[model samples]
Target chain A: MTTGFGLNNLPYGVFSTPGTAPRVGVRFGDQVLDLAAALNDPVFASPSLNPFMAQGRARWTEVRARIPAALENGPLHPLTGVHLHMPFEVADYVDFYASEEHATNLGRMFRPDSAPLLPNWKHLPVGYHGRAGTVVPSGTGIVRPSGQRKPPNQRTPDHGPSRRLDVEVEVGFVVGSPSPLGQPIPTSAFADHVFGVCLVNDWSARDIQAWEYVPLGPFLGKSFATSISPWIVPLDALTEARVPTPPQDPAPLPYLTDAEPWGLDLSLTLSLNGHALSHPPYASMYWSPAQMLAHMTVNGASVRTGDLYASGTVSGPDASQRGSFIELTWGGENPLKLHDGSTRTFLEDGDEVTITATAPGTNGEAISFGEVKGRILPIQ
Target chain B: MTTGFGLNNLPYGVFSTPGTAPRVGVRFGDQVLDLAAALNDPVFASPSLNPFMAQGRARWTEVRARIPAALENGPLHPLTGVHLHMPFEVADYVDFYASEEHATNLGRMFRPDSAPLLPNWKHLPVGYHGRAGTVVPSGTGIVRPSGQRKPPNQRTPDHGPSRRLDVEVEVGFVVGSPSPLGQPIPTSAFADHVFGVCLVNDWSARDIQAWEYVPLGPFLGKSFATSISPWIVPLDALTEARVPTPPQDPAPLPYLTDAEPWGLDLSLTLSLNGHALSHPPYASMYWSPAQMLAHMTVNGASVRTGDLYASGTVSGPDASQRGSFIELTWGGENPLKLHDGSTRTFLEDGDEVTITATAPGTNGEAISFGEVKGRILPIQ
Candidate 1:
């Protein structure tokens, strides 16, 4: 119940002082323990976690076991005096539509005359590749994107700043180890390749997405900026968070069947300005991250170090649990009343959004994923 | 012309000899000129073209000007004795629907009741990101991808090897300089950021793409393997190939309007098992590569040095100019007759597909893109 960065949970990140170069560090109780000076390993001195993560899981486990003792005497810096950088260089980014509630809500809003769920939704974890180069660290300023958008009532499309700017709360999985080409990684090997978890804010432009996402999926609407939490919470720290997923009705194909339960009982909170808007339950998601990885590589596609895959917006069964503003505001028909005596249908210029998550840790502490925060900047 | 590797076309590539690591080299006739030894710059000692390409356009021009003179008296090796590797490290891969004929053919085949062309086809270029990690070099064996597919007549989806494996003949534009985050690269700056052109074989599984591309676009269906030509023909070498793009019915938005005609008069030939099948004309494409790049970053998506964007299947009005097997065979209703009297609707096991291209060079000779060849391996 205290601070989430306790002795039981040490999340990794890259930080630097005013004039110093960025290097790997671990968050431990308001201070960053420098891994390079403590471990005497040059890999930790890298600006990104890719070099150490590429050393594979065995080395990761060995180094992680020694982190507690190293923290006792390592060079420590105050968290407030340090600047956080992107933890890893993103290789490829893929976002999946895994939430049944979110998908159903979107389906009903987008296609009122048809069934809520697409036929391929349950058969596979629907996903598409995103702009990896645009993946930024937390606190990056998000400029309001300008593109073509045609509302339902408009005959000709108009080009300008997006009117329906929004955010999607989701969990991100980071790949540490790589797999070979022409080889598919099975669902059971998910933990061996996936290094850790982080929080993601997939900013979206619904008006641009509505006009363009036909036959080829979302592009510029979701690619402008995707923000990620600076710290990465390793899977070892989440041993107490594993839970069984909900029963699947039509049973997935054999390749997607999980040998062990891979669900994490994490809770996410989305906030705008200073008010908490929603708390989406990760357990309510229909598909597991392991199944998503398995499905991604089922066609012999390889994975590389620093690859990031995100679970689509986490939405629960209730209206208050929706992760995206589109669902929360019901396609701009309904507006959310804020504590500051203002109502909002979509994000406005200068509006700031923050997403945070926590999971159960050993010794009854909570493992925090920190927060991914961004402010919408006016068009330049 | 003689071989494509003429003096006028000094295409850059990565190659290695026995027991030697890969390094940057340039093709001058049948010899591989070692740039590291020729230019005395260590950047050419890199295994990929990313390092040299990141030095910006001014540095690229300076280095390119010295290449022809250096080739006269530089250290060289026979091309036959060296092994060609992936020319550059891919940062992000995007595929664009720029061809009018190919889009119309697919639209007619996929949605028979509707108009052949979508409404947004003329207004904006339709594109989607593809897996960058799975992009392999030329001659890499492509494994048959297995995924879920459902024919219209089938009640339920089935999981197995794809029955409609296909290829897309396209031209790829490689980015040589990095752009700032939240900044849009204009259509006029196409040559300033883009380095060169190459051939790409976008191997796709038609069945899987058809089933899953409803709301999210292509994923596993096209992620298995994308083969690119080993050599990259720099833009400076193709001065004579510039032409005006086909007329637009509705004038594009102001941002997409090009200051200069960015169209390239490149002719592509597709061959199956050494038998020439189709001759797709890149000149007939509706949208230019500059327009694709302008629209891609108009929403403030940054592009990296090694980022690659490919023109979608180039097709002409004639049936013999179709770029994909699905179009040539008319969705399997008609089979293509091969030179050996073998009728084929889709790629078979051990089938080798090669795509090559040529553009007008400074001299009367043509500039060749070499070739991107891949053989289909049986499902492992």
Candidate 2:
């Protein structure tokens, strides 16, 4: 299979050279094409990719078509020694629990005696708003969050560093076109609003989450830091990855039903301390990105450019395909033996967790979604 | 009592004349002092207050001191006929269930089989991130949201316009100075980081919320539209209104405790269709703003300049002082008697709901918060 940044994969990001300001660039092969310098326009010179993202899908397509022709004679910058930043200014972050396998695994582990899934699990896409201010770019250090956590037998919660910190491997969708308030963008219009996709490491504090996520949803437990890959693989580049979603047991409502194949077949791999932990398949997710977006905006919530939504956890049916440590080790009852002769139920200080993924491309090639990696640091 | 905009209460907002661009202005009495035009500088010329808000407390104090002196000879425009937009660009919105009365009311109404209060209700200021894209300014017509709602007897949720619409009376705290990631801001540093407070109307669709908010939390039920007053009342102006929060039964942990009395005794009155409904008291909240801020950041989640956190449904002890229609009307078991002899279990199209509030000012006078009013429009 063909690999590397081929013609079919020109992911956009923000990068800067030594002593230079950040500008929008496209990754092609091992080089970066500076869009602002090539176009000789200041529109793409912003520190973040929000301006370029706000240009909408038509403009985006035009730029995509124009960039390759402009690069034939334009100056190219070496990809080495360049600092990459967050591609866009995140407006809001929404996380959806759309993976049936992951949700069932969590339900079974957390509530052993009760049903695996909630009553409304099959009817709608379950999601909640997340902290957008703490969305950092890839390579940012993950600080172990200290908060109140209650043991099962404890009367009161104790404040300390989280002992059950974990990583949730998922794919995130980025919104490019915004929708006005009181308008619901139908499932068929997903391509018009969504710009691209990226890999996300939703670092979670399971101890804090278990104690605090009652009545309301997760807050500080999952808000400390959410890391995303710098490169954004545009939706147009993933045409070959489209696949039909699994049939719903109970038919979805008319608003959520899409006539097209909305699922993208991608393979995600998670590693910790240079040891392969799991391979969560994104293709097995029960809900598609179109369905998730439709459910989110059906109630008239406006969508803004730079808004982000992530698949909760891309776990598969097998134990080795579990996306989080809680499911893999069954709530830390059984620890995982790493290749470095270390056992871990949760993340430890100095442990580097890396997640990488790839999707099907044209000409029997694969489109790479680089990597989102972060090393855990002791609580400050 | 000081009823009008006094010397101490100089609230800031963004407004524009018919022929000019939007700029930051300070509301004083019946006029607005154009800060940008008055200072002969364009620092405050941005459409949103984010740029000026990021200047930190020292610069804010400097501007506050200099604005009044310069206003003596500066251009003063009448407040009437000016288009008021959202004061600041919301970075992140968090809604806190800090009011004991509201939480207990909700618990008693929804979960009659269990305790009225959740086990973790008093342990921490329970909160969740809310949609920031739909946070509108006051007077913006609220389009009735349509979503799927499952009745108790129905096996599947049915799609339609929300039958049970309500509003949550709240006071929102706006952050001006941001904190670094991994660093928790102490309660004493609240004044240094938070700029002001504004009135918020957290619109809710009770039926939709009840159906979907099980495993996660409120999503579409509360994301439709959240309206805030145009003028932001600075914390410095509320010095005389400060009061001690109600004592906690199980005393909070050290991280959630504060030495200062951070509660402001604001009287919030809710009206539907020109008839009084309830009078929720802000002083009845069990948690203080400082304590809430501390708890939110103790887990290493960074705060941004435009981040906003609202005191969820400020209900008092009396049933007449309930903040939401579900509580005041007791889950619609009893319909509210309107001024025109019409009855209402929930809001109807063309019905205007207005929330006005005031706090104690210097010398026994009252500082007005200025009303946050919105008329309900039919779902599009």
Candidate 3:
């Protein structure tokens, strides 16, 4: 819908600005737009703007609401475009298991008849703590794991480079403001901690995850590599794209229920190794982000900024639209044929997969969370 | 029994020597004994000492096994005369909610009939993400939190000082070397992540926790302030203190079942800042650290060095043995009458509290975790 240059699409990213004070910048086309310079000018200046006027590098949470209320809402919002770099400085990161589709799918495979959902799943947002120190921005090559794998003939797990590194398409959102000790933020305040959203491709080692997940959740299966896009789309901009909640079987508790339509109508697709023919649409999800956010706050736990709540393996109703080939083929019974004649239920090394999503809108311009890409490398 | 200053009375703490590097120290009377230096000298060492030395400070997991060997063989260990500090540098820290007595006691008032424990309760350890950034050493003062709070009778929360600051009596174990990713650490490998145990008093802001917990689990409610003693008591030292796990209604998964009696018969108690009266027996709890550890690995979660999982409250059947004033008073219903005639459930400004836990050894000398103390100051 946008006829002019899409300056409004200038998503901000955290970056180490050279020489100048630590601050923020907006990405327009291929260049970064600096936000600090405008703060000193008459057009943009205030307390919120002060977070962007740092000395070296600042986190998104530090200057989240500061882009001048007027700039965010008025005519100058789209007019200002100063060149700058990416705008992220992540301190800690956490991933949450929110989608019922992803949860149920994984659960069904574990316990078909009884996997309605582990009883505690409905009560709280069950999260296994992840490694924050290892979280890296997008384009970082994911490595295939050489771990204990079980072959049918062996008693002990075969130790070698895993041939089953897989990709999971997910959305990562940033936390803005920190909550108080012992206080749980209500649904209304979920956005307060949400700085923005980014594209996420959670790389997995399916073989490793299955073998190790008996007493704990994923370890090396997850630690191998998880990728996320560099750009951050603020929550304020996605107001128009929010969707209704999917169907639910068991009624959620007071904490999980909400009035707002929480899911995003994101047109999501994935391309394996740059083969344009492999991409598919993303839908058929039953849970919404609001439900996940609401469920998370029930424990009175405070979520930090830069924390990412992943939907796990997001898939559609059928084979082609299915997110992961694991569920798409029901674990390897039916293999998926790649464009280059490689048939697989999972990924192999040196393979690159890209996932991109865009929210639908009839407004001036439709906002999109760009592609999340990762290439697998053989582990020594 | 230990009649005089004897072998059984040794305590542990983190200390730094005037000329040597910082490392784990064993406490004897008022003087400090260094373990690393003694391990290097044969006059102060033994064959049992070789195992401890083999692990080097970089891999202190062997400390747990070596402690018992050193204790059993009787006094040839190098660390005896050699002065040591608290322990090695904590590489990472992860806290857990392991005690049902503590969980139920705390959950009873808030959740009434149905608690949050899932089917995995009897089998696996339930835990959440913890902050390693604030896992400070002993003698750190806990600051009263200044955060947004819902004032009494107000629908909207106001930014104010935390009113219900409390302390939790906890036990923390350190991991030695890192576990390979995606690998399930067998019970035999349990020693890998453990350097030793310490008395930890997890400070909590009950009022703030009550208000903010929802979508995310405890964040600021805990991260703002946490305190722990400096010693790393080898896991072997408490073998004599082993007890049986209490019975549960439902059976747990096989992974959660203990291979041996896992509970420790240590006498644990809390003081009002350090003044105390008689409390219940320490063997009154229903779970063990081993069960918690095994439960953590049940789902294939890999643990790293410096992770500190805790036994939530460590309360007994009686109110007197309660780990926290919050559990002792049921949130704030039971106010504590201090030695100075002060009565309240929460900590007051300048209020000091100390907690000490010990395992009575075969000899009269008690193997102790020593004291973890902190004073609460008004929010700055």
DockQ, every prediction: 0.86, 0.88, 0.08
Per-residue lDDT tens digits for candidate 3, residues A219-325, read 55665556777677766667667766566555554555566666776667777888642333333455555555554443334454444556555665445655665
Task: Give the top-scoring candidate (DockQ).
Answer: 2
Give me the TM-scores for chain A across all models, comma-separated: 0.99, 0.98, 0.80
Q: Which has the greatest TM-score? A: 1
Indicate whether candidate 1 or candidate 2 has the larger TM-score.
1
Fnat computed for model 1: 0.83
For candidate 2, the docking band is: high
- Candidate 1 stretches with Cα past 4 Å from truth are none
Residue-pair clashes per candidate: 0, 2, 79
Candidate 2 residues A117-235, lDDT tens each?
Answer: 99899999999999999999999998999999998999899889999999999999999999999999899999999999999999999989988888989998999999999999999
- Point out where model 2 deviates above 4 Å: none
lDDT on C-alpha atoms for all candidate structures: 0.93, 0.90, 0.57
lDDT of 1 by residue, B99-139 (tens): 99999999999999999988888889999999999999999
CAPRI accuracy category, model 1 = high
Error of 3 at B329 (Å): 1.1
| Candidate 3 i-RMS | 8.3
